[model samples]
Target: MIKKNIYFVPLFLAIFSFVVIAVALQLDTSPEMIVGDSMQARSFPIFLMILNLILVAVLILQFYKNQPNPIPLEKFPTWGSMILFLVFYVLTVFTDMFIGIFVVMFLMCVLWGEKRIWVALLTASITPALIFMLFDLVLKIRFPRGILTNIYYG
Candidate 1:
């Protein structure tokens, strides 16, 4: 019997990666200028895309160099987590990144055998605030608030 073509899996991934990088590179951030920073608004997206491309290349190299067997992938949240995050990502285009991050973190924690409901919920609730403090205050990065901006304006 002929061996199945597993090489296409990595090839498809590389192609998808290229498409993502192309989309990110084509994004228009010209509406506003990024101030108070050494890098421009486009810097982050461009940097991320290039990094992703580099990682794809590394993955290809490793696949060829090692020629590992195609073991069955992990079950449970491995693929589901990826799809969930992708859906949340699409939702973030309309919603805020902060809320999305909070929801995902909470969901992951709960999925990871978090026994105590109160403890799990509390950790999720406070996670966003702590992250805000660390990123917004300590790291000096601002996050979008979506509809919550008006409520928190006071």
Candidate 2:
């Protein structure tokens, strides 16, 4: 039913979060004296891990609570949408982050039945731009600028 499929998304997220946490745990998080003892590199990962665990716990609890009330399957999107999402996600690894996210978000909105073109465009553009600004400007993290970026600068 729709309820069951709905749960799959959260379950997948929980699993993915756990995987991230596992990878984070393996990172050398030891504090550098230059950065100070208060700024242990591991702190952020540990914080993320804790947050993920909390989310997973909440998801599991919700899954149990909703298991008895499954909705009809007719409400669900076509299975191909999920497959497409996965495909795009993998492809994004090889593409520019911003472009990949914009394309994917637009396609996903259309695939999941967003009817308004303007809304879809806004969602696609705004979301990725916000993420880029947050990571690049605020967090000082770098993102791969794909071929288009090089061409633009040239």
The 0-to-1 C-alpha lDDT of every candidate, in the order given, reads: 0.70, 0.72
Indicate the residue-level lDDT of 1 in model 1. Answer: 34
**RMSD of each candidate relative to the true structure:** 9.3, 9.2
Name model 1 segments beyond 4 Å from true: 9-68
The candidate that wins on TM-score is 1
lDDT score, candidate 1: 0.70
lDDT tens digits by residue: candidate 2, 55-95: 87887687777674545565445675677677676766776
Off by over 4 Å in 2: 1-78, 148-154
User: Could you estimate the TM-score for every candidate?
Assistant: 0.54, 0.44
- What is the Cα-based lDDT of residue 28 in candidate 2? 76
For candidate 2, which ten residues in a row score worst on lDDT?
145-154
